[model samples]
Target: VLDRIYDFERILTRIETGTVSPKDLVALRESLAVIPQLKQVLSGASADLLHSLNDRLQTHDDVYDLLCRGIKDEPGLVIRNGGVIRDGFSPELDEIRSIAANSHAFLQELEEKEREKTGIKMKIGYTKVFGYYFEISHANTKPIPDYYVRKQTLVNAERYITPELKEFEVKVLTSQERMLALEYKLFGDIRRQIQGHIPAMQETARAIARIDCLYSLACAAYDNRYVRPSLNTKATISIKDGRHPIIEKYLKDELFVPNDVTLNHEDHEILVITGPNMAGKSTYMRQVAVLVLMAQAGSFIPAKEGSICPVDRIFTRIGASDDILTGQSTFMMEMKEVSYILKHATSRSLLILDEIGRGTSTFDGMSIARAVIEYCLKHIHALTLFATHYHELIAMADDSPKIKNYTVAVKERGKNIKFLRRIIPGGADRSYGLHVARLAGLPESLLKRADVILEDLEKNGGAPVPAKAPVNPAPSPMGDSLFSSPVIDKLLSVDVSSMTPIEAISFLYNLQKDAKEGSGIQ
Candidate 1:
């Protein structure tokens, strides 16, 4: 519907001024053609807005049919150059074109008509002396028509002319000019006819634009397997197996792990997410904002299931960028945005704050981050997703039921680590900056020196990293520890002691093959 919308505005304006070109006229024809399709697309839609728009849509079938036959498919740009109008549209235009294109045929018909009228079998000829004349042999005894005025006399033949012949000569000579003039008139008449329906067309175009937006949203929903979230006035945002709409598009089906979020007005009001860098902290916060926005905007969200509450406003402080023109540093912009959030944000709002205090010294940044959290808990009390590198923020979860701690799970393989990209209930104290540096192509010697320095700092009580994860911590990946499949589950449940030796062996072999097949290990 919105494919060629770029040309519609100018086309309508030109139609009003009576100067629309044939190329632009084709655009109008295409717009008129979409009316039926629009009606069909919105045929059974239950939305009152869509139904009203459908009602407002006028089917200008006559205008469409006229334009289809009036203009050439591929016409010249300028109307005066001719070839703009198709043949057989206007009888007068077609006749003028015939005269210009078939002058010789007309002359033959003229000679035949004179022969029939006078019975002389006169032949037509032309010369430099006289333009066109009829010749008759003197040997013939038949008398020439008295209406033929003698033009030339010869020994054995005589040439004469008629008023009709002279009239045809003038017409054949000036046919090109007359044809161009008639084509221009026919094009203008068609343009005028279409001009009267400009208001209807403009309304139809607006309808198409509206449909285009909704249709695009629908396409996104269908392509990404997005579900329509149940919207309510309640104070909870619960989603099961939720996904980031953008991140999932480019990632492999199994590679992108889905996480669940449950935020409400009371127990789980503020979620404190702690994770290492490049672990999707910001992505999770943004996903919530985007999903909420989509639900409120009447579009589907990328989640297996969703039930969302409408937020009055969604405030975000996610990325790090400076306003160089305003001479504002990253920290200054961060404070300003947070100030605005605190001032305007209400309890029904959603606040997505990421790394609120990393712009200054440790004490100052931590102090500001803590103060913001306290303000959220006491005064503002918004449904917030606050992400931070300050691990001390996790201690707030113990004191307040409104706060909850979440971390990104990972798998440590000797010196290498893989981000599980799953958010679980806990906190992570170690940022693994050295590991990330090694992954980023840092020199091995520098990594070794940094590790040594980190060890010294930990020993000296500067940055306290635990020797292991806390007791009964969230599940972290281990090395191939009983990878589960249907075959494995069956093997665990089956009573092998009752089976005979050969039967047991056969069952084991079949189970191995099934496991391999299930794992896609062809």
Candidate 2:
């Protein structure tokens, strides 16, 4: 019924136009006309909430009747026109309009009487620049009547104003002006009466908005075959046959493969998901988070069966983005978000950290990923889904019983691989990055070169270090070459891991100064 309500916003806008339109007045009347029916239906509803809402809605009968009797059904757009007000709404305004209607005939009759009295070829004419004037030929100026006062002189005639003409002009113009003024005044009165019901209308609007949102959600769930999930305070989440709601909604050909997920505080607090790109790692984690959020929000989840632990907060560090203008690199931004999660997350929180340390070198990133997983398991104990391509993180499960390893299953065909899109209890054997790269249209020669590098690294365990470049010979102060000094070499080789951030900065500054001084470069 609320959805059927039309032109409410347009009516409000026309009120803001100050000089309200007849069409807008009629629109407001139509909207107000629906309120009585709405209130009656709501009042008769069996639900207590509906009954209470009905108590708050105003019918505004006086305003409605005023508008219905005053404004015409098809009142034209502007208010200045004479037909804007109905005939019987205002007697005084009607009388003024009647006088205005006969104004032309009255002026004609007065012109003829004046012409006979003056007898000097006088004629009455009207112009916007000069209201009503009597024109007398210049040849008859000597016999110009004393009653006529010259207003303007033309080439062959003198334009003159008479007291009778001025009085008639005031009566005609005043009547038309007052009629318009009265119509505007009546419209304002009706608009203000409607404005008085604003508080009730606002309340009704809020209730309708909430109802509309819930109805939309229910419709979506029904159309997509969703089920309601049970929510609890167990600090654990378990879902069976879960699928990504949005992805499933848009899938055209192949059926979306559903996956299962389990998270608890004691044994499986952290699931380190490892898989090749596009193998459904991110999608699975996101599905779990979405189901939990939906359950807590009192909406159905897109799953066969599910139970959610009501999470206090959900922290997602999913995508890669940076604040480059603020001088924060991508890695720094990632670390900052990580820091925020660590500081704010509680045991009851849900954390979805995807590619946590991916913005830096492999070893540094892997090390950070390991530390974050350990901290979440040992300190926070939050139910966390940590998805990454850093396959080495799977090793954390061996030492920590709270950590679990999961992977998206993949099947390899001759030179091509198919993503199974299945989550299972085990670490991924290997990331098929090369296969993904090939799929991404990498050149065959580049793929072969990468294959050679991978084979060599597999044989040697790691890349071999490059040989150091020869140092440039230069003058040194302190009676010795700085590059050859044992003290300088030891200083350069000191363990930086033991230094704090401030201490490291100071050490770097002092080292640069010392090198400059020793090389005699000032």
In terms of lDDT, which candidate is strongest? 1
Superposed by TM-score, candidate 2 places the C-alpha of residue 346 at a distance from the truth, in angstroms, of 0.8
Tell me the tens digit of each residue's lDDT in model 2 across 1-522.
Answer: 656666455456556556556776776677778777777666667767567666766676776787888887887577766568777788887777767888877778888897687666677889988998988887885577787889998999889998989987777778877887888787677677667665555565555555456657788789988898887677779999998889997889888999999999889899999999999999998889888888887788888999888989999998877897999988898999999999999999999999988999878998999999988877888899999888988988999898899999989997699999999999986788899999999999999978777777668766764444669955335445456575478687878999999989988888777766766776
Give the RMSD in angstroms, all C-alphas superposed, for model 2: 9.7
- Candidates' C-alpha lDDT: 0.86, 0.81
Clash pairs, candidate 1, are none
Taking the tens digit of each residue's C-alpha lDDT, what string does model 1 give over 190-261?
988888888887887777677777889999999988999998777999988888988887886556678899
RMSD of each: 21.9, 9.7
